[model samples]
Target: MTDTVADVTPEIAPSSYDAAQRRSDAIWQKIESDPSGLRMLTGDRPTGALHIGHYFGSLRNRVRLQQAGVETWVIVADYQVITDREILGDIQGSVRELLTDYLAVGIDPERATIFTHSAVPALNQLMLPFLSLVTQPELERNPTVKAELAAAGKSAMGGLMLTYPVHQAADILFCHGNLVPVGKDQLPHIEQTRVIARRFNERYAGGEEYFPEPDALLSESPTILGLDGENKMSKSLGNTVMLRMDEAETLKKIKKAKTDADRQITYDPEDRPEVANLLTIAAQSTGRTPEDIAEEIGDRGAGTLKIFTAEALNAHLAPLRARRAELEQDPGYLMQVLRTGNERANAEADETLQRVREFMGMVY
Candidate 1:
């Protein structure tokens, strides 16, 4: 781990934490040391409704971290919409709906500040300087950029799409975040941020580490595969289970969900990915081990597993649905949350931008 404070080096270890309690201790320790303020930055692009894959993947952890007293900032990355041409048409509406979903899902404005990428101009300015620091080979190596290029069917990628990792660095460093919650797939982005932060501090902080080398707060949850059991759960793929899905829709999806051909049920992702996907979902939703769920439903047939998984999912989502319904009644309240959060976020971001400008001798 990189040292964020003078003479203080963070410890790096391959954690024993299961999918739930994985990075809690390490995160808490960092927060404890910087109680007055420890910044955390995380966000999603405004594309569509957040699904169960999102809830179980990272948003759930964001709520817990916010409540734990870490200063959290969630950005609605409206600017990233240009990366995927399809989303550009409805990006505005999607941003509004995404904020509504965020409030409904327990991202409290009082506890965490939320803002839109388009609303922050200074943050965007950091991207240009950041681009100069990183090379084309470095950007090309980013896994997400490669995947996105393939997804967009772009044989020759645009410069903006290729340098997204730099934009992500600006997102975190703009807010001076000390910790960022990200999955294994996003580890490279955080790695890039560390390099940028270190380079900036070394060159600009007058020999002092003004910006902390942010640490990755890894999720303990297993990567939630999509309902198709083929790839990661995603809204675009139509394989996601929405967090606010009604009982009927939930059941309908599960009924048609894929499963293994074998008559016997087993939790083997490698050998039987489809069956294992269901078991993983069941385990996560019911707080049971995949093996335990498999044994309990042994020889019951896929129908039984589908029914049970649907019921477990519905039960798990009961509170979130109720909370969402209550929040939906007052859309203005959610807007206010974003408005207030934007103010706070802008204030914090401005502070860092000011420091950066002064360091680079852009202003006296």
Candidate 2:
């Protein structure tokens, strides 16, 4: 990847690209040397079950950080689900499914705190002062927010939607999470969070660092294109293989996945995106380069390539699927894991909130 990492979202200023690269590299180096000293906050909205894209993209990194001994917090962001949409579909089930995926993929709740956004009141409370620190122009300038609004076909941005980045800042700062794993599109959010942290410490704490301005831990994972081969893998599009899917189900999905007409298979993303996407999947599963996978499968055609990719993926995910099945059988255990994490997160949030109140003389 270049200095920009990937095709960055428009909200991130083009000028900040190289700077972000430098900062990301430096933070990653520090993490490698002293992983235990860092705190990381990263999560997803519990909208639905996770898929291969989520696995290889961010979830893998989350587990790696947790195993590396970083104090990790995975917020379900339940409240943010309604930021754009009016309806809240099966949040309870969604949260459970997300937890199952988390555990099945080696995210130890004992090591990483996994909690809901709604459960932590103090975390939400931090959003108030954080909202004050950022200006209206700054909020409107966020490309991700604008893109989301456009995607959702909403002419007017909701209050939560506009201040979404503020909520994110609170999520990170409330727990003193200084290392945030995010892709290029989310880099601007981390930058805005840093601005909020800087302004708060300067204006309220007399420039004495109260919040560690979080750094973006850029993900090196390639964007996993959907089975359609045209768009990014998305559940809504019916083009994803869910993590909970069994080996047979996954193989069936792969068999039906879109592919090119050319018989001679090669890894050329610009030209043969669909075939290359399958190769990428196989490569990620087998820990081999996509180019190597393509070379090995030369002239085998899409049928052979699909079967090869499916087998590799199934082999990689077999253990995770077995673990997920066990977790599903014991619903009580899953809830207990979530409840324990929520309690720990609330305690951490309370301490941070009390200190913030003291800093601003609102401790009455």
Candidate 3:
């Protein structure tokens, strides 16, 4: 176990963003040219049903990468559910729902590997060696770990909470995943994973590269603010529209979303954030600019804006919702897909573990 934080560290290393962005751009080109050369690991904790924020945030990018021929591994991260939460709320159901959401968003089982954390023992075994590579201070200083701990509202954190970043490193290296899709806030976690990979190679692999220093694939999508128009859209905040919501439900949520009293709708994000947020949602759905959308809805109050945003969002989600409905009818297929993924991941993790053991001269 590790101790709690008495002080804060820089959330992200100041100079790393430019370098990360440069590498990300170059990696994007490589992916476009030869996607088969790269393996990407990206996923969500089974906290709850995904919302439109998730859809635009990362799920859409995952679908794009899968379609682009990148080898993708989507981990359910079921074990991570315990890192912050005290009560294990319906995790089993959340796992199933996450699978459905992935498939519903076009993550083809045939193209991507989707597995849960607890299913692969060999992968978790990598944690022991990886943990040894870093000092306790390193773990304590990790910005992601600190932020997560603060979010959980705990004055002191457990070992799992403190070492969450290391576990993530194992998740990537266990499968030798080279690219991780993330937002800027998550870059520090990727940096920590890279450190673990480099350290392991130096210490046990005799300065030979055993694990690839995974690069952060930052999301280019604009941040999707919650309906409150104040914070990022999150399920925990109760300010997001779930992907499974019907048209009526979506409309109800959107109608209740916050917007300013300005009679003439505009797209000035700095000054008119609330109204601009609604416009952004409408723009993303209808494939138009927020400015253009606002112009079309000129002089319309929040009531009309809400209706327009809801209609556009619903229309965009109509196909996905229909696919989800069909999938809901056959629960067995979803479970089978997970079982198959788990088998494949276990095989991969086993091979990686064997190599790690050999590298450290623990093969006897």
Candidate 4:
């Protein structure tokens, strides 16, 4: 919330944190002053349905920027979904669920352009030129690549998997996304985007600058944790309170969520992740701080904390669930939204690719 957006990742270099946080502050301040002109790119991979972690980390910021008249583009990154073969096995179902979550979370079809990545061929074309611009060592050096490999539990990955960040650069630049709202863990990937953009401009455009260097727009909310309290809330991990969960189901999940046995709840993420996770959830749900929530719940037992958390969580998700239900019942309508978004996104992608091809002398 302050200039010091804490880098929760212990492995991140301090210099990296400082540079990213400073740039993030500048981007946030500029956008806050005049959001109308800013173009934003943010979205999910559709590897699975979005959950509370997704909501607090980036989805909420995407909605906020779109509502503020930022030229917002959200991608259901179907291409990225296949980075893991296991994901490719069920991407179709996951894409459907992803669309439902996007609509459920108030990503207005008319406001923010939300499209499937595969729908925009022009964007994908940009990646080929970009791949040559970045080196294998550069890709291997990316912390996000390491993190992804670690998360996927794969020591061996494919060429495409290794160069996925290059694909992301294509995604951001194709839209001229000057503002990329993401959590801290994603800053490294955005940094890679910045690098690729810089390299492309230097190599092809003679550093005159064609693509905007996208900055990480850190959300005001701290990173949301899973119910297990040990890791990030993830659908893959089966620790998520899904965005479109019904009231009763949401409460049931929250009730079963891990919490400390402490009688008096305290907001200590480092020491008490479960209690802190609940407190953070309650804060986001009620527009209060975790510290404030902890104070309000003084002397409250874990049972009371669970009750309050469930109520807050359900209240926040109630309208979203209703919207999701409406959208799910009309699958044809959801597909239409993606199609419309694709049309709009493809127009922009074509323009970007035109410029890029000209720069690369591929205009024949």
TM-score for each candidate, following the candidate numbering: 0.88, 0.96, 0.96, 0.93
lDDT of 3 by residue, 1-71 (tens): 01112212236766899899999999899888988779999888887678998898789888998899899
Please give the range of 10 consecutive residues that has the lowest summed lDDT in model 2: 1-10
Worst lDDT 10-window in candidate 1: 1-10
Clash count for each candidate, listed in order shown:
2, 1, 0, 0
Candidate 1 lDDT over 1-364, as tens digits, reads 1101011112223352242134445666766565456778888887766887778877777888777787888899888777656437687677777887787778888777889888888888888777767788988876667776776677988867888788888888888887888665566667788888888777767768887887778766687788788887766678878876799999998888888677778889998888888888888888999999999989988888889899998998898888888877887887788778778778877887888888888986
lDDT by residue for model 2 over 1-364, one digit each (tens)? 0111122355566778778888889877877898766898889888878999889988888888787778888888899888878989999999999999999999998788899999999999999988889999999998878877887777998898889889889989998889888888887788899999999999999889989998888898898989999887777789999999988999999999999888888899999899989999999999999999888888889999999999999999999999999999999999999899999999999999999999999987
RMSD of each: 6.0, 2.9, 3.2, 3.4
Evaluated at residue 296, the lDDT of candidate 4 is: 79
List residue ranges in candidate 3 displaced over 4 A.
1-10
Each candidate: what lDDT?
0.76, 0.87, 0.87, 0.80
| lDDT-best of 1 and 3 | 3
| lDDT for residue 227 in candidate 1, whole number 0-100 | 79
Model 4 C-alpha lDDT per residue in residues 1-364, reported as the tens digit of each score: 1101112342568797788889888877777788766888877776667788878776777777777778878888888766756536687788888888888888888888888889899999998888988888989987777766776678897777788788888888898888887766677778888888898889999878888788887767787788888887766567888887777888888888898768987888889988998898999898888898888789978888889988998888888888888988999988898889999999999998998888989888
